[model samples]
Target chain A: MSSTINLFMAAHHKECDELFAQAEQAVSEGDWEDGLFRWQAFADELEKHFTREEQILFPEFEQATGMTGGPTQMMRMEHEQMRSLVNEINKVGTARDMDQFLGLSESLMVTMQQHNMKEEQILYPMTDQSLTNAQEIIERMNQ
Target chain B: MNLHKLSLDTIPPILTPFRFFLSALLFGVLAALLLLYSREDFWFTRWSNSNLALTHLLTIGFMLMVMMGALYQFIPVMNGQLIPGSKKLAPVIHVLMILGVLALVSGFLFSNSELFQAALAALGTASGLFALSLLPLLISRLGNQLIVYLLRVLFLVLLITLGLGLFLLLGHALPELNLPYRFYTDLHVLWGLAGWVVLIIMAVSSQVTPMFYVISEFSPRYLKILSLLIILTLVVMSFYTVFISKQSGTDSAQPFIYYTLAFLLSAELLVFVFYTLLKIAQRKRKIADVTINFYRLSMFSLLAALMLWWVAVFLPLAHLTYLLAILLIYGLAISIINGMLHKIVSFLIFLHLQKLSLKRPEAMTLVPNMKQVISTRNSQIQFMLHLLSGSLLLISVHYPALTVLAAVFMLANFCWLSWCLFQAYLLYLESRKKILACPEISMSL
Candidate 1:
């Protein structure tokens, strides 16, 4: 039961990582149309992941732990940071500026990877332990 | 799990790590200057004062300085707990380390007893305070346990290395102490190089390679086993050198066992280099990142060093050993660090600025993105300088007269590194000021 959340969320993180690589590769290869398609797919998947955590998992964890301003808040802030970068990358995508797109994507990659690390390595495990209905919470997040 | 420990805000003030990074580059410049000043005499022997001074300057002055700074930033985040009072401890430790390295290098260059004593005091206190601050975090069972465990051993080895260093310094400061300089210094170098430096680099690679390069994680169980074997071999070799080899001083078999141990250690490092290269090649992100190139070059250097170590053992050439050390130190370790500095500094600036923008939403537009903070053009130039100087330094081992030319390039290499970092810092400060000013008008109203 405890391992379920870790397994589920960590898999989602890997899926997002794969999407990110595909998007980055397409852009690097100068396929603007395909690159934009892949990038949008990545951005959408990432937003959905962030939403799942923030809307379902985070509030549950917060309620379970009775702490509002903690790791979740930091994660929320990082989500906003990534969101801004995602928006910037969209602008770069439209302009088809390879260097600008690469630069913005690189920053997003680092920011997103580090955020996922913290969540997978620390927060998710804590979520597993702190919440008794781990399966149900993960189910909610899946939707 | 202390919930408060997970707060990313616990990252030390920007200056804490940045000061150390900039100072490390300056010391790198100092090292190159020492090379130019000493000229060919620096290559006279591994035991020469000039040689020792140069090694310390690069090792303690540059490599260790940067490592400590990275640790301050990395450990807190990785362990999910900040080192206690890190903001205060970091600056004091940075100053002491700087003073200590300079004093230690001076003691070697001039054979000054007072300088040696000063170095001992400064370094001893600095490492002591740092170790004390980091102990709780290292002991915690949070985050990645293997990395935490490896970090714990790194600190322990560092203490042993420091202890050996101080004993050697005592022999220099007070000749009457009559310490066996050769024996103790061998142990010191072994602990410092193989034990502390190599292990930390490998540990860092395990974490960074997967995260930054989009590769699969190295098998932790396998890594743990490999780490244990390396430590076991080091312990056995040290024990042989200290006790068994001395008892059977005339036995040719003793030297054979020593060489065998050395080969085994080199083999382990070879395995690490190959494994890392394979991972780098396997990275899903096929971007032409400068840092990935740095990793490849460093791995190549490591492979070269390992082969040279084997050759040095069989041939018993005086200079080949020196070349091996140079490859390991400058070519391998320093190259990886140089690459990391670019990524870490840029990301740090972006992170802090992002945090600031989060606080002051109006300032969001003012933040410089990561690439804007440190342009790829600047880093690519730094890479070329680093490669040229490193190649020249390798060649200087064979042709001693080229030492000055190598030194000049080395000086340029470090100065360029300094300029790159300084430019990024300037960008950070400029962006930070603009961000702060955004809130000013609102508050005034």
Candidate 2:
């Protein structure tokens, strides 16, 4: 179970990084169409990731730990911030202004890269260690 | 987009309801002070030292402070992750931000002096530190493209804005340096207003609008690109015009760009308002809360004000401009803040109480409904008074005496808001005490 969770989380991290890099390249080239597309893909992956956690993983953790109102809450707020920025980026893209797109993209890239590092380093490992019944849970998630 | 595991115990203390109350009170007092001291003659008369000081007091002191506290508490619940430095750093950031605000406000009111320079330095350092501390928390959640983007944009803009402000302050303090004050000031306002303030608002609105209404999530692709484009255009156009003005000396291009940006911003705001209203109309929850009502009213005011602004652009009437500013600042912004505060405070209290009840099951009854904490009647009265005061003040710009009455009414409204919040806090304390006393009974089985 632990290994499966680790594998999935690691894969997720790499995907996020790739998206970030793609977004950076697109913005640098001033190809806002591609930049916007990559950003949306990045956001979509994140939204799916969060949904899976909230619906599948978080409940299991809550049941196992008998604790609530901690990391889950923080993640939700961060999601809100990310969602807002995505909206802002899209707005800038529509205006088709390179400076605005780049300025926003620059900030988004830094924030996204940093955020991915933290999750990959800390949260995933912590979860893997704590959840003893991870194999069953992973199988259930797959099903 | 890693689904990391985290335990409930990892939640930070600074993200609790108590800290929110503390931040809110501090910001409220500072905002009130700005309102009391602000001169109508100089209000929006071109972003001067005093204007910058007052604006920062509202944006950094009031808005950002509240936002940080809310974010600290909220992020944990949203993401299942704890903020790394929330416990120790929250208070440190809060105190520094408060002191910085005081220094900047006093310095601006008094004009160029050693104290002003010290205040600017304190504020700049505190803001820098706050941004630094937020880096870890921000980094942890980078999987979410939308939030990561917003934070990055806001932080960068904040840095530029603050840096320019510091330069301007230094120039004022030491005139012998011979810095081009006008140039820096223009850039500073541009970064501060367009870059930091508007971008953050836009970023926050995307999440808030959907969450509040439970609407279908905004089309991420369109929203993200659109917001970035608008802010970027405004910022670049502002700097470009400024550069052009310096070269041409008698150019009106700056005003033209300003008008264009305003129109663009208004259009964007309209889109936001429409989406929000549409969602609200479709909300499954039939029973409307006070916060939702206030939110709806705020949206109406925002739309009306935007239209008025466009009209005034063509008409160029002083009265119309004053009216629009009042509607935008006092009407739309304040209304939204009021609504948000009511909901956020109540939700925080509920979350805290729920947590407490987990340990002490007997005190479950003590947890108050959100309605008890927020008084709709009081909010309604305050909103009406604000509208009345705004209308009167707009007319009173010509008849300056009327501003006194507007100020008086505003003071009363602020007092009422403070009282309501205080009352809510008291209720929260009482509820906590009851829960603590009956711990065994309140514990979750």
Best by TM-score: 1
**True-vs-predicted CA distance for residue B136, candidate 2, Å:** 2.4
Q: Pick the candidate with the highest DockQ.
A: 1
Runs with alpha carbons beyond 4 Å of true place in candidate 2: A1-143, B1-5, B8-11, B14-54, B141-143, B184-187, B251-262, B319-325, B441-445
Candidate 1 lDDT, B1-445, residue by residue in tens: 7765477546778887888899999889999998999888888889888888889889888998898888778866676666776688788999999999999999988989899889889988988888888878777778767777778777777787888887887888776778787777877888777777677777888888788888988888767777777788888887888788767764354677888898898888878788888888999888778998888888899898788777776677668768878888898889989999999999999988887777687887787777888889988987898899999998998898999999999999899888888989998889888998876323210
The worst-scoring run of ten residues by lDDT in candidate 2 chain B lies at B1-10
Model 2 DockQ class: incorrect
Predicted complexes: DockQ each? 0.55, 0.05
Candidate 2 lDDT over residue span B1-445, tens digit each: 4334543334465244355456555655555555556646534554555556645665566666666776676555445465656777667766777777777777777775776677766767777777787687566653345666666667777777778877877776677888887676656655664455456556666656444433445577766776677667766666665677667774464678666766776787787678667766765333334667666766787777777777777776566644654565556556666667766665556546645665454564566645455555665765676566556655666676566566667666666666777777788788888888883643122
Worst 10 residues of 1 chain B by lDDT: B436-445
At residue B337, what lDDT does model 1 achieve?
90
What is the Å distance of residue B361 in model 2 from its true position? Answer: 1.6
What TM-score does each of the candidates earn?
0.96, 0.70
